[model samples]
Target: MDSTSGPLSGIVVADLSRVLAGPYGTMLLADMGATVIKIESRQGDDTRAWMPPVLDGKSTYYMSINRNKRSVALDFNDPEDLETARRIIGRADVVVENFKPGSLAKYNLDYATIAATQPEVVYASITGFGTAGGGALPGYDLMVQAISGLMDLTGSPETEGFRSGVAIFDVITGLHTTIGILAALREREHTGRGQLVETNLLSSAQSGLVNQTAGYLLSGSVPERMGNEHPSIYPYEPFPTAQGPLIIAVGNDGQFRRLCNVLGIPGIAADERFCTPPLRSRNRTELRPILVDALSTNDAQSWFDLLTEQNVPAAPINSIAQGIDYAESIGLDPVVRVGPAGEMPGIRHPIGFSRTPARYDLLPPDLDADREHILNWLGAESRLAAQSRA
Candidate 1:
C-alpha cells in the first residue's frame, strides 16, 4: 500500500474482525492509508462464502470491504500460526476485533493481554449487543435490527414490520466503530496511551433511529409503523404522478408554498388546515389527495424537473443502477478501480480530504496471499535478535 500521503500514513492496523461491520470499519481506515493486515481463519472470512454476487468466482461481498488490505490466513490451534498472529498484533498501532466477549481470552489475543505489553495500541471491539448482560448473544445485523425496534418501525401500518432492504444497522455500527477508533487514536496522542473503544449494533441502531427514538423518549409515546410517511413531516412521502410515484419533500412553510404554486394549487398553501407544518401533518388525509391530484397532471419525471426548478424538493424514485448513474451524471465519481493494475472496479470511499485523499492501490487479497512476505517480515526481527546476541 502507498502510505505516503493520506492522514493515516504509517499507521498499522491488525484486523481480526470479519463479515460486514468490522470489515467495513477497517476498510475506511485502509482507504485513508492505514496499513491493515487482515488476519483470517484457515477457511478465510465468512463473507468469502457469501456468493451469488461473485467476480471471477470470488465473492464480491468479501471484495467490497476487503480492498487495500493484505490477507494472512492462520489457525489459532497451530502454535506457529498463533505466534505469527501475535507478532502482527504486537507490531500494530491499532487492533480491531468483534469476537464475543471473553472468546479471545483463552488465546491471549484479548484487549487486556495485548494492552499489557503494548499500552499505546488502540483496540476497538464491535459487538451485536453490549459486553455485559448480552455478551454471549451473536451480533448479527438482522438480529440487532429486530431487537432495536427498527423492524417494528418499518413497513406499512396494514402489513407486518419489515427488515430494511440492506443491513442498515451493520453499516451504521461500522461507521460508529470507525468514529470511535478515530477518536481513541486522537486521544492517544495527548494521553500517550490507548484505551478500549467499544461499539454494539443495537446501540448504533437506536442512535441511528434518531428522531423516531427521540420522539418516544420525549413524548412517552411508542411510535407505530407509518411506512414511508415521516411522523413529523407532511408532504414527505411519495405521491402518484401521471407516469408513477414522485416524492415531494416540503420541509418548511416556504417549500410548501413553492410546492403548492408548482402544483397550481396556490390557495391550498394558505388554507388554515395546511398553513403550518404541524397542521399539515395533522391534516395529511385531506392534504394528500390534493397534492396527489395535482401531481397527477404531469409525468413523474416532468414534475420532478418542474418542482426542482421551483426549489421544491422532489424526485422520482430510482433503482440501485439509476442511483449510481445519477451520481455519476452529477459528477460525484462514485466508482474507482482497485488493484495494482487498477483492473477491478470498486466503490470510492465517501470521504474527501483536501490535502490527503483516500487511495486505492491494493486489490482485495486471495486467502493468505501475503503469507510469504509477512513471514519474511516477521522473521526479520528474530534474525536481528540472534545477530545482536552473537
Candidate 2:
C-alpha cells in the first residue's frame, strides 16, 4: 500500500459538524489521509464536556473521533467567526456538516452557497430525518433508533422496545456519510463539479437492518426478539452450559449434522423432524432443550473451542471490553492511539482499508487550539505569501 498516498491524501475536509455522526464520517476521511480541519464553536462541540469517565479532564467521547484532525474553533454565532468559517470552506476539497436543516442556511453556508464558490467541492450533509418533516428537529441517535423501529426489535419480548447499548445508527450513518463523500468524489471526476450529498439516520438504519426488514416484509409479521435467537435459523442461538450460554451458529445442514455428531446424536440429522434447516427450525422447541442438555456438560470456552475446531460458528457471550480485547489479540488492533492524555489512551477507528487504512490517531484538539493558525491560512496576504513561498 502507498501509505503516504492513500486514496484521499490531497483531499481537505472542513468538518462543520459536531458529536458522533458527522465526526465519524470525517474521521474515516482523516484515517485515509484527508487534512480535516474540525471547526468547532466557542463552547466547542457539546460532546466536549460530556464525560463521566474523563480522560485528563477531557471527555473521552469528544476525543474518540477527533483524532488526526486540526481543530479551529470558530464561533459561528458571531459575524467575524462566520467569516472565518467561509474562509475555511472556500479552501476545502470537501465540507461535512449536520446543522439543523435551516441553521446553516441562515449562515449562508448551505450546499448551494458552498457550491457557488467552491464549485468542485464535495458537500456532504448528515441529518436526523430529512429536510421536510424532520428538518427542524435535532438529530439524535436514540431518537432515530426509537422512530425507525430499531428499538422495537432489539431486546427480550418482556423488555420490548429496547435499543442497542452502543450507537449503532450513528456509526452506520457516519459510514453512509463517508460512502456519499467517496461517491461524490468519484462523480466529480466526470462532472468536474461538486454535488449535494445527503445521508440521514432513518435511511441508514432502515438499510442497516436489511435482513430483518426483508424477513418482516416477506412474512408479513413483525419479527419478535427472542433474546439472541436467530430469526431465520434454528439452533443458531444461545444454549446454556455449566459456565454460561454459548451462541452456536449452525449455518447449514452440514453444520447442523456436525452439531448433532458433536452431541452423539447424529441420528437426529436423519430424523424427519430435524432433517433439514426448515424442519430443524420447526422443531427448535424440542431441539433446543436437547442441545442445551448436551452443551451443559462443558463450559463456554470448551464449547467454543470444540465448535471452532470443527469449523462451526460458535462463541461464548463476551462483554464489550472482552470483545475488543479479543479483536486486538487476533491482530485486529481495534483501539487506536489519540496521543497521550496524562497516560490515558485514545480510542481507535473501526474502519480498516487495505489500500488506504486510517491513520488518524493524533491527539484530539483542545478548545480553539487552531484559531491563530486557521486565521493565518484564511488571510489573503498569508495565502499569497504562502503561494509565493511554494
Candidate 3:
C-alpha cells in the first residue's frame, strides 16, 4: 500500500501475530496505510506451509492475508533479538498479537509490559477463548465453529453436524479485532491513552450467529437445522430449474407477486394459502410443489433473468470462479495484483472509502524480506528516543 495515501498513514503496527485471525486483522490495518511490521519467528508464520494451493511454491494462504506489510523474522529465545522486539513494540503505535494467556511475559512483550513503556500504545490480543476459563485450549477455527453452535445449525438434521467450508469464525474474530483496534485508536484521540483490546473466536461466533442465537435467548427455544429452508421466510431457498438450481428470495408481497408473474402463475400471489409472507411460510409444503413445477419449465439462468427483470430477487447459483466473473462483469474489480512482481492475485478488501481509499501498492513480502532495513530502522528509532530523553 502507498505509505502516505490512507487516513492511517503515520500509524505503525507491530504485528506479532500469526495464522489466520491475527494476520487477517493486521492486513486490514496495513491496507489502511499503517506501516505494519510483521514480526515472524525464525521459521516464519505457520500458514506459509499450508499448501495444495500455492503459487511458485509459496502458500497462497499466507499470501492472501499478508500483503501491504513488511516482514522481519526474529527468535525470541535469542537475548539480542528479544531486546530488539521489545524496543520495536515499545515504539510502535499499535501492537497486535495472538499468543495464549501469559505466554509473552517471558519475552516482556505482553500488553502490560509494552503498555507500561509506550503509554499511548493500542494493544490487541486475539485468542481462541478469552484469558479466563478457557485459556489453555487451542484456538483452532473448526473447533470454535463446533463449540459455538454454528456447526449444529449448518447442515440438515438428518446428517451429522458439518463445519463450514471456510474458517468462518476466524474471519469474524479478525474483523472484530480490527473493529476493536480502530475503536481503540479513536478513543486514544480523546483520552491521550491506550487500552488493551481483546477478542476471541468463541465470543465473535456467538455474536455472528445473530438471529438464531437471539431466537433461543429470547424464547428459550433452541433452533435446529432445516436444510436449505429458512426458519422464517418462505421461498428464500433454492428451487430446481430445468438447467440448474436457482435461488428465489421472495422477501415481501410485491416480490412474491413479481415472482409469480414471471413464473406464469400470478394467481398464486392471490392464493389464500400463500398471499401473505407468514401465510406462505406457514404453508410452504403446499406452495413448494407449485413453485417446483413452475420453475421446472425454464432453465435457471432464464428464470433468473426473467425474475430479476420483474424486480424479484432471483439468481442462478454460480461457482466461485463464476461469482468472480459476475462481479467483474458488474464493474466491481474484485481481484488485485500484489507484490513487486505483480504476479500474485489477491482479493480486494470489501470496504470502500471515497477519500482515504485503500492502497494495493505492496504484494505480500517474502519471509524476512526487510530484516536488515527493519533492524536499522529500529536502531535509529531507539537512538532518537535516547537523544530526546537526554
Please give each candidate's TM-score.
0.97, 0.92, 0.97
For model 3, how does the per-residue alpha-carbon lDDT over 8-72 read when each residue is reduced to its tens digit? Answer: 89899999999999999899888888899999999999999999688899998998899999898
Model 3 residue 216 lDDT? 95
Which digits, one per residue and each the tens of the lDDT, describe model 1 over residues 177-228? 9999899999999998998999999999999999988999999889999999
Prediction-by-prediction clash tally: 0, 2, 2
Residue 58's lDDT in candidate 3:
90
Q: Name the regions of candidate 2 deviating beyond 4 angstroms.
A: 1-5, 340-344, 351-356, 380-382, 385-390
lDDT of 1: 0.92
What is candidate 1's TM-score against the reference?
Answer: 0.97
Which sequence of candidate numbers ranks them by lDDT, best first?
1, 3, 2
Inter-residue clash pairs, candidate 3: 1-362, 339-363
Whichever of 1 and 2 has more lDDT, that candidate is 1
Best by lDDT: 1
Residue 369 miss distance in model 1 (angstroms): 0.7
Which ranges of candidate 1 are over 4 A from the true structure? 381-390
Looking at candidate 1, what is the lDDT of residue 312?
90
